[model samples]
Structure formats: C-alpha cells, structure tokens
Target: MQYYKKDKDKLVCLLCSYYCKLKTNQIGICGVNKNTGDKIECLVYGHISALNIDPIEKKPLYHFLPKSKSLSLGTVGCNFKCPFCQNYGISQEKNIDKSKYYSPKDIVNIALQYNCDSISYTYNEPTIFYPYAKDIAIEAKKHGIKNVYVSNGFESKEVIDDMVGIIDAVNIDLKCFNDKYYKKELGGNLNQVLENLKHFKKNGIWLEITTLIVPTKNDTYEELEKIAKFIKDELDIYTPWHLSSFHPDYKDLDLPRTSLETLKMAKKIGEDNGLKYVYIGNVPYENSTFCPNCNEVIIKRNRFEVLQNSIKNQHCPKCLYKIQGVYPKMKTIRKTGFAGSFYPQEKEEILKYIDEFNKQITINGSFDTRAMIVPHAGYVYSGFTANIAYNICKDKKPKRVIVIGPSHSMYYEGASIALYDEYETPFGNINIDKEYSNNLKDKYNFLSFDDNMHLEHSTETQAPFIKHYFANTQIVEIVYGKMPFEDLSSLIDEVLEDKENLLLISTDLSHFYTQEEANKLDNICLNAIEKKDMSLFDNGCEACGKLGVKALIYSAIKKDMKTKVLHYCTSFNKTKDASKVVGYTSALIGY
Candidate 1:
C-alpha cells in the first residue's frame, strides 16, 4: 500500500488525517495504514471491520432529512488513537481479512433493498479506507444513492480535492480548540483538521460539526467557548454545532463521564457566541431546534427522532429567517482561530525555510565541523531562517549526536537528560544511546525523565534531519536554562575527544520586537559569533534561550571553531502585521 507524498525521501501517508509518513516499512500513526509501494492504498481496503443500518439522524445530520435510514459501514484504522474512542474494537483491531469485500455494486444493491437514503463511510475514519469507499461511492451514485462521511476532519487539501464532488454531507468531529489536546490526546494537529473543515466549505459540501465533551479532556468552559466561537466565526454561525456528552472508554476508562450540566453549559456557550442552530446530543434532553430570530421551536425532536419540523423551504417557518450555513448570508463571517483559512504566509514561510536549508548546504565549514547554533520557534516564525547553519553540519556519519535546548515549560529547572530511547520527526525516529546519556548524567547535574522530554520539542525537532543524513547515530537531548557554559562545554569536549560527536544548539534570537528592531539587535550577536568573540554579546540579547546560545558560543570559541550564517527570519513574516517579530537564525561552527 502506498500513501503520503515524499518529505525528503521519508514518505508521508495521506490515507488519514494523521497523514503519517513511514520510514521504510513502518506503519502510520493509525498503526494499520501504511505507504509501502507505488500508490497509497489502504491496507484494509474492502476489509470492512464493521457494518450496520443506522438512522440518518444517528449521524446527527438534522438538516439533510429529518428521519431517514442509512447504511453505515466502517473499516479498521483511524487517524488518531483518541483516548475516548467509542468504537475501539473495530477502530483498533489490527487483523485484516478481505472477507468483507462486498463489492461496490453489491453494497449499493443491498442498501437499495432497505431503501436507505444514504451510504455512510464512517466509524473508523473513512479516509483510511478511501479506496473501498471511493469505489462504493461511484456505484452508489450511479444508483442515485447519496454518500456521507463522519470524519475527524484532518485531511490534506490535496486528498480532499480528489474526493470533492463525491461527498454530499460531512459531520466532522471538532475535538477541541486547543493544540495541547490535539498534540497530547489526539496525536494530530488541531490546525490541520480545521483546514479540512474550511476545505469542505470551499469545495462545496454539506458540513455540520460535533464535539464530544470528554469531561476535563476537552469540556472546559474556556474550551467550549473557544470551539463555539470558532464554528460561529470560521465555519459560519449557521453551521450546526453539536455538543455530545462523553462516557469514558478505551485508555480513559477510569475517567468519569461528562455531566449533562456541562453539555447544557456548552450549548449556552455556542448560542452566546452567535451560533444559530446549537444542539446537544448523547443525553436525555430536548432535541428541538430553536430559531435565532424568534427563539421559537422551529424543529422539534425526540431523542434521535424528529417530532415536528417548522422550517419552510429551509427558512424559519415563523420568522422566515434564512441561515447562512447553506446559501443565505448568516450575518456573520467565520473567524476560526487557526481554524480560519490558512493565511498563505504560514505555508510560504515553511517552504522558505526548506529553500534556505538547501542554501545552507551551498555554503559550509566542513566534514570536521562539529559545533552548531539554531532556533526553536514554529516554521512560520523561525524555520525559514533557522536552517541556515544546521544544513551545513553534514559529516557523512556520526557515532553520536548531542542536542541542547532550553526548558520552556517552566516546571523543570537547570537541565534534564531525555529518557526516551528514540526521538521522531517527519523523517523518522533517531535511536538514542540511553547508556551513553545515562552515564553522562551521572557525570553531570542533569535530571533525566521521559515525561519532561515529551513536553519539550526544541531538542527533539533537530534530531531527525540530522539522523536522516547521518546513519549509525545515537542521540542525546539536553534541556537546560542557565547552566555553566564552560562546564557544559568541557563535558562535551571530553565526550568528543573519545567519540565522533555532533552538537546541536537551539535558540531563537530576539523576542517580540519588530523585524527592524530584531534585525538591528540580532545582527550584533550574529556578527559576534562570526568573529568567534563571546565577549561581544550584549546583556540585552533577549532570546528566550539566550543561555543555550551563549553556552554554544563559549564552547565553540573554546574549541577554536569557525562560523557561517545559513538563514534568518522573524514572526513578522508569519503574522499579518510586521510590528512584532521573533528572530531566528541558523549558524555553524567547525574546526
């Protein structure tokens, strides 16, 4: 099976929103999906893990048909292994048998017998079984059968375009507004999912949203408000916002279920945020749809059953209020946070960083060069300019690698040695020499833990590209704030003398200054490094990780290293206004 476009030889699987790019034969984040050959085929294609005849309203799509029946089908594998997975048996089951290949024509004919209004590709990520679903959709459409998708909404724009016209309605699960929930619980990017929702709207599809309030996981009042505001502003106020109560399952079995009070509060948040058609699900409550204009019960419902509908030609029967979700303007333009349409600058900046990285390869110190200095902000804010020096640190192969970065979470003090044996990136995981780091920690004052390392990305992000080029590598991560530069450097020198070692120092330049101010001040620091003079650095150099850079500079000078500037960037390039900028640069030091 093949999926994912190549990211510098490492393949990214676009079968699901996780879009995991495998290294060699490794599977995606979903575990079962893989990109092994020429085309990205779902390994479980036609391998229907579960099948059912469900009510159209079970999909919680109130706008389509009040109470229609649909044939719902699902296959194994999901883009994310969410802790509160409702259908973990089929979603997580790894065994694949093609016995479920009921053929596209067969599926369509069966659905027709039951007079199902639609055939839904749902349950365990429809995108994972794209090949089967696409085939089934083609046959179903020929028979005048509609198709629907219940997805996590984390899709690449390219993937969505390929299936544009075939999809009729989609109910995307908007997990949370915060990135931490996405990174920690969902194992995906929140912004990427938000992008898919926008793409659905742009490409023409019926879109509704659902958010399962998993107690503390994503049911906070702040989170609820953010989500409501996002849907109202970004996807449109007329977009139906469904807040479903959650009962613990899967890995979160110990957690308590979300209270009905919480769901009610969340609905209030959505209504207060200007969402016209807010509804609650998964609890015993009124399912009537209220009109934003007259506050009248426009559409009455009982459980997943609709009782009486007051909408006439899609307008409120009483007030004749037309909503913006479809064609009529809803008096509001969606302002979806990062959920909003990507400001092209975000993508351009990342590409700019890659080009600058290639440029870094153009100018260099050499094979024996071992020291480095870099930045640790997002690709938009610092990446374009951060790869200048890191790209030049190519020495064929290194026996070991040491990456030092600053502690940003504020919980840990001084420095901490990573505990995980491997670190990952778009490229792959770099196996860490635990024994080496453990021994080194015994030789220093650093604390070591896996949890702390997981919370930090500065050191982790730098390891992959380095490992990609340099094989037979073992990595060590050091997260420090203010440690003895000379002392740290001395320990590094001792390690290098006995083994082939490479150093990676991550620290952005100025903090929140304008591009002009950052350039003026950061230039002084860059020039000082070019001169190999640590004393030239002023005290006002406001890099959040200044201590890390200062230590690298001191160590590089002590080791008699040479320098080169690879790239530079400021957040002004990422944000609409260039008034405030965060500076980042890539520099190299080698003997």
Candidate 2:
C-alpha cells in the first residue's frame, strides 16, 4: 500500500517510473491498478488472463533450470504500448474484469502441481501487477520455488528493491538504445529501463537481456553495437543477450518480418562487444549454450527443448571452466525425510513391523487388485491397516505403483508429482518411473513437481511398505491439496487402463474425536467404500485424505471393480484412550 504517495487530493503511484498521479477512483496508466482514495488497489490481484506450463527456454531462459518446466502466468494490461508487441492482444487489452481470480497460494500450488521449476510473470509487464506478483513471490519462496520476471525493465527503484530476494531471475527487454523511440513509439523511457537493468544486475538478480529486432527500426548495426557495448560495459560480459526476431503483429501488421540474417548480425554485435552468450530467438534453428572460456558447446538445444547439457557441477566438462548460471543437478534422489519418526530408521525395524502386522492380521484370500486404500500413520497406530493391502497386493506384482495422498504439511491446489530418479526407503532405494512420470506430467496440466510436498508422511510412509512387498518395482508419488476429486479420478482411470499399474490411495479417518464418534464417522466412510457409493461421502465421512479416497472410489466405480474392506481399527486399540481417538482402515478395489 505504501507504493503510492498522497499528494494533496491525488495519489501518485510509484510502482513504475511513470509515477502516475491519480484522483479518487482513477486508475493508473497500466489500467489494472486503481487509486481508491485510501490506497492503490490492484484490480488484477487474483485475476489471471493467461496461464500455461512452458519450457524454461521459452522464457528464453537458456541458463536457468534448462529443459525444466515453468508455470507462466500473466494478467491483462501493460505499462508500455509498443506497436510491435507480439502479445499485444492481451498486453494492450485492459478490461480484465472477466479474468478468473487465482489467489497467490493457488498460483504457487499450480506451479508445484505441474512440476515446474519456477513461476514466470510474463505475457505482460509484471511491474503493473507488482502487488500480485509480490504476494505470489512470497508464497513461492516459502516452498523453495524460484520466481522470474519478464519485464520491460522500468520498475521503480522501490519495487526493484523489493524484488531483490523474491525475484530470482529476470529477462528484461532492452528494446532499443534510442530514447526518442522509447518515448514516442513505445511510450516508455529508455534511460529508466537502462538504469533499472543496471539496478537488477547490481542487486544480484540473475539477469538476461533481449532485443526484438524490428526490420529497419532497431536492427541497424550502430544501434545494435551501442546496445551490446552498454551490456558489456555496464553489465557483466557473461550476461546473455537474446536477439529475437520481430514479426508483423497487431498495430504493426504492415511491417515485414525480421530476417534471420539481421538476428545473426545482432548476435555478432553482442559477441564482438565482449558478451559471452548471445542467442537468437524466434528462429527455427538450434541455439546452443557454449563454455565462455573453452568455447565448447556446453548445453545443446533444439529451439527450446534441451537435447544435452554437458555442464557438470557448474563447470564445463571440456575445460572445467566455471559457468555463469543456475544449473540443476544431473540426478535427484528424494531421501527419507520422515523415516526415523513416521515409520522407522533401520531396515530391520521396518521389516519387523511388517512381520508383526502380517502375523496379527489374517485375510481369507489374496485378490488381484489394481487399486487399494491404506492409512498413513505411525506404524504403532495404522500399520496393521496398511499392512493388509500390501500383504494382499504383493502377488499382483505390478511393474509400477503410484501412491496418491493429501498434503498434510502444506496447502496446495493441484497434485505434486515426484520427479526424482529414486525414492529412498528403509528397505532400499526404489527406482522412480521417471519416463512414465514425465509422460503423465507432460500430458496433464494439473500434475506438477514440488520437492517439499513429497516430504508428506502420507506418501513417504507407503514407500517402505512398497519396497518390502514389491521390491525392485518402480513407483510414482502424487501429493495433492484442495484439488477436485473428479480430475484426480480421471487420472486414476487413465492409470488403471494399464493392467500392470497399481494405485495406492492413502488416508486416515476422524482425527481427535471420541471413540464412539470416530466409529460412527469411520463407518460412513467404510460403508461408502464397500458400496462404492460416492454420494455417501457427503454424509460426514471425515477422512483427511477424503479427496484421494473419493478419487479411488470414482475410478473403482467407473471400472466396475468390486470393493472390500480388509480391516478397521481405532487409535484406542494401541493408546487405550477411548475419549479421543483416530480411525484407520484398509480396502481393496478390483475384480
């Protein structure tokens, strides 16, 4: 709210360099923020116009999380009115009341659910939505997720200061070196953008520069060299310069498309000016990342899809020269975050619990099941219920097992798909079905990656059981929060289409209730599952993972699979405290 200043009867917005002064009920030049006589309110705070999961390279971010996915979102309106803006359709359109509202948490959850490495504020100038972007950035930082700004580089110094830690990386547009053109043609200040570029670099935000080379406009050698030299002298030589081609669009429909030769010329100018990495965008040919010192291809790319990255430990494989950008580890392993407490630390202790549970519970016959519902609580509490399913399904021996559960420790909207090479358990390491997981993620917009969400005990507790029962089989863990059961059910149905894939849905019922109350509530869930009656869930079945349970039920009903409850118990069985108890259960769904 302090981003604005009260001047007499008018308020001056300091979010951008324009410094727009507005009367009561007046909006700023961006058309998205309004001065409501008290404070400047972002009209598009929760309104999202465009949202998608795109490759990091499409942000044109060649050096950051290369080959990884990013959750790209933007609202309508912009500070600049460039005629040649390729996305001008949305950027220039200011009436955004019809745009759907997504709270900051929802956006972050979507990013995590999609397995995106970062969240990019793009398609329009992010500075216009500073309040919205700042909120989302704060939430994203909490989960160790990175934030990116695709800006025109004209943010006010105060906003840039706020972005120092929140914004991890940026790709700013240095449209041209001509201040007259910036002011007249683009309705922006070249000096302001240039100053903000230096500010972003000095502030430690990973910086990259892009220039859309409009034919006969900013494609001249002299201007290109000036822009390149400015980057070399002011910014570090390692800063990447992207020379993007301009196509006729929107107001500039009569203008010709930029030739590849002009982009190559700009790239050459950047290199000649001591820039180490210069890429050509909007071209069909491959643009590769090379070692600055050794001049060897460090990362190979076919447009946006990275084919190969040879940087190892942030160094060039050829010369061991230090690289200048963020690099993801070649291999990722999700280690046991809840093993010692949630289950057991030692392999023997875990096996002992399994052995004891097997001895204690006896089911009549083994069933060939495609899906099962298990409780995710400490072994002393719910191991007996969970063991029943693993003991029965071990004979099915599906090639891959997918574990879906609710996020108990965090609030996220969509499902998080674990994208690790391996999942660690007390029994041993379980190989993750990377290929299959990636295929699912690539196919669905709701499925994503969140490293922190995978640490939930609901998903982690099931890993050891899977390893002890189905050794050497691959697994995928999906942790979801605030998601629609219908969507998850569709995904479950798709997985069940494959005869060899087993789905494990984790949940615990009626927490911290009296034993009698717990039993009554737990019975509703049990009856619903036994009858495959999803309608009964609304009648007060208080399963913490009710969404996952509902999804499994929906899938089971659609596949016409029969449901059977193997066991049900309350915490009173172990704690001997009937006053307050938690409920647990195990069930199976198959022919």
Candidate 3:
C-alpha cells in the first residue's frame, strides 16, 4: 500500500525492489502497476490469469500443510526476467486481453467451494498484485483458509511488512548464490532476495526455499553448498529446502535438463549443512519427508501426490519425535491388501495357506536370477506354480521388484504405475520403490499414474507372494492395457539393465478351457517363452499377459539370459473340474 511521494510530476513506486518512478500515464517496471492521475494503480487488479486446485507439495512447501490441497490463482506480469521460467507464457507476458477478472470475495468463495484449506498466489509473481492478494487473503482468513505466496523473493521491505499478518506461508525461489548471475542473467538482486527471505522468516511466516538447479549454471557443488549453508544459518535448520530440476524452457532452450545425480548431490549438500528437511523437486519419488530425529520416512510423496503419511499428530510414529509443519486435524492411514476375499484377511489363515503352498513346491538350487514369469490366479489354483518361481529366485534377493501385468478392468494406452507408497498384503506392506519408478516415468513417456489400473487383481494378487518372500525389497507395479509389444520390450530392457531390479510378469495361461485343450494351449505358450519367440503371439497363444510375456522373452533373448519352466498346472488339479479349467505356469529368467 506504500507509494513514493510525487517529485515534480513523477510518482515513485516502492512495492518491489525495483522502486521505479513513473510519470502521468506511465507504467512502472512491472507492466501491471501504473501511475494514473495522482496515484499508483495495479492495472491487473482482480484479473486472474491462472487458477487451479493444486497440492501444496507442488509448491514445494513440504514443511507447510504437507498433503493438503490449495486453491491457487495467479495474475500476469513479473518484475524479474529469469530466462528459464517454466510458466513464462503467463509470468513473462505483459498483455492482459485473455485474463478473466474475479473479485477478492469471489476468489475466497471459490476456494471454499473446492474444499481448499489454503489459497495460493502462484504461477506468477504475487508481489506485483500485492493489493489484490492482500484483499483476497484477508477475506480468506475469515473463512479459516490460509494464505500462501509462491514468489521469486525479490519483494522490498515495505512489501514484506504489508504481508506480515496476511500471508501464512511462502515458497521463495532462491535461484542462485552468485550475485553476478542474479543481476546480469536474472535481472534481480541476490542480496535483496536473501534479506527478504530472512524478513519473511522473522515475521513468523512458514517459509520454504526452492532453487532450480540448472545444469552448468547453479548446479556446481560449491554453489549448492553455499546456498545450503546460508539456509541453515540465516533461516532455522527446520526450514525446508526444495532443489528443483531445470528443463529447457523459454529463452533457455539450449540448456539440458537437470540430471538425477545432480539433484541427489544437491540434496546431500543441504543435509550436510544441517538443514532438517531437504527435498528434490521436478523429479518423482524423491520428494518424501523424513524425520530429523529418527531418520524414518514420515511422509511419502510421488510428484504432487501424497502416497502415504506415517506422521501422527505431527510426530513420527516410530520415534514420537515432533515434526515441523501445519498438519490436518485427522491423520490418514492407507489400508492396502486384498482383505476378506482374494486371500484371507485373517493373519493366521493367510500364513497357514502360504506355508501349505511352500510345502507343495520344491525349491531349486540357488541361481543368479534376474526375472520371472508367474501366474496371478486364485491362491488355491496358482499358488503352487507361483511358489516354485519365487522359491527358485529367492536367493537372488534383488533390491527392487518390477511387476508388469495386463490391466483387466480399465482401458488405457501405454502403462500405468501405481502411486501408492506401499502395497499391503497379509504378510506385510510392500514398499513401492519410488526412485526407480519415477526414473522410469522420466525415461519413458508411456509410463503414467492411473488409480483404476491398480485395482485389477492381476497385479494385486502378486503382492502377497512378493511380501512373504522378498520382504525387504521394494516393488513397482505397472499395468498395461493395450501397449505395443515392441514398446513393452523396450521398457523391459530398460529395467533389466539395472542389475538390482527383479522383473515379474504376471499372467495366467488360457482362461476357461477344457483340461485337455488348456494343456495344448499352455504348452504352446510355455514353448514360446522358453524359445524367446515373439511370433507365438501371432499363432494365438491364449495367455492374458501375452504381450507382457512376449516383451520379457524379447528382452531376455537380447540379454542372453536363460529361461526355465519351474511348474505347470491347471484349476483341475484343485477342483477336479475337467470340463472347464484355467492353466497356470511359472518360469524363471536369469543370466
């Protein structure tokens, strides 16, 4: 609300660090604010350029409302000129022809209607529209909605003073530690931004910092260390630092995307500097929060989605150590498992059934196995066959398991990856390996997240067996609806190259056929799998996961891995129903 005194005919604006003085009918450096007649006016007032319901985690505010959703809105125009602006279309543009106007009261009502716990001024610099944001935030507070600012951290002392009471949280972009890059490249002052960061923290705002680690720019170890140490020293050790990856965008099209290795190194530097909460952004699976006391995983996240939260009453469940964040009143625990149906929900009964299945199968000698193809039918029907494969590969003890199966209930292209933190079974929870799963999604454009695909029994049925055998290993489940075999093969090859990954293809042979006919069809599939032949699918091998099986064979053959058939049976073996039966088979692939 502060404007400079009129000197002669020019009125000076002091809202941001630029402090541009304007004449009559002349706009400030930020195109949205102007001097008309006697006063400075925000030209884009009440004009909303972008609005959406987004997870607070996407703002990279891990320590503030960890898993809640916020009604986010942003107006056009920014004071600074960062070359690698991800939202440059809206942030860098000065035009306002396409923006829609929403009053402060109307914006708060929309946030309430969407069940948002907070209102975020994001996508563009909120400082330029401070008056508008202040009005909306004041209105929002009446309805018990918090206010958040996702800014570039170049606001002046007057702006921070105005935001003291209205703003509840903020994510400031601390771009780089180098003052030269801040002034010459980004057209902003680094020291001013750093001083403003301390001001926000001092004003009782829940502050978090984000630094986009652009390759060959601000990604060096020395620069990252300096930034990390500054956060730990100026801000509290509890303040969260989010290191985001930079992609080629806007004027920085020639720069390469930030590598995973670089992001990991930056995270380590922040941690080494004694910052309690450090996270990697723009990269999946690396955004989880851990307790500083016990180092236990407290909140698990996948991109913008919260997979699971183990923190209860803002304390670690394992150590009862207090965590820093604004948490919801009620804690949510995800209950996973095929309870009361697929397998017995009763602990005693499920353990007994697994023990019986183990007795029925004979364990082969230990071998260096890399992958396996197993059936996913009822435990009574396919348990013995599946057991044989797990028993053969139990010695390999791969650190991560990838389960690929056909999606029976939903139809979608490519493959779907489950975003759950853990897949629960009667045996135990199977932790989803987020790092590898996210890396796969990054490498292959075909991989994505779909809740419906994860509901199918094909992939879910394999979890209990994996939990019982590979208890320490993490799992990644992929359900494909109608992906091409060649694309599937390429995806499999990518997983196989990682020596610690154990791939499991889930499929039951020939559904609903006579015992004799099922045998003939199952044998065709068995021979094809052993021979690594992709042509067998053309001959009508009736396996539900024929595409996945073909992909395994194609990749296995190329890697010179050997395949072995462990066991083969049918539902007839359990029910004695010879007229109608489904075939079951198990095999192991190894180098």
The number of the candidate with the highest lDDT is 2
The digit string of per-residue lDDT tens for model 1 on 132-179 reads: 888898787754568889988876566688777687788999988889
Model 2 CA deviation exceeding 4 Å by range: 329-423, 426-591
User: What lDDT does the true structure give each of the candidates?
Assistant: 0.72, 0.89, 0.85
Q: C-alpha displacement of 245 in model 2, angstroms? A: 0.6
TM-score of 3: 0.55
Off by over 4 Å in 3: 3-8, 329-591
After superposition, which runs of candidate 1 have C-alpha atoms over 4 Å from their true positions?
A: 1-11, 23-26, 323-591
Name the better of 2 and 3 by lDDT.
2
Q: Rank the candidates by TM-score, best first.
A: 2, 3, 1
Please give each candidate's TM-score. Answer: 0.53, 0.63, 0.55
lDDT of 2 by residue, 456-509 (tens): 999899999998889857899999988788999999999999997999999999
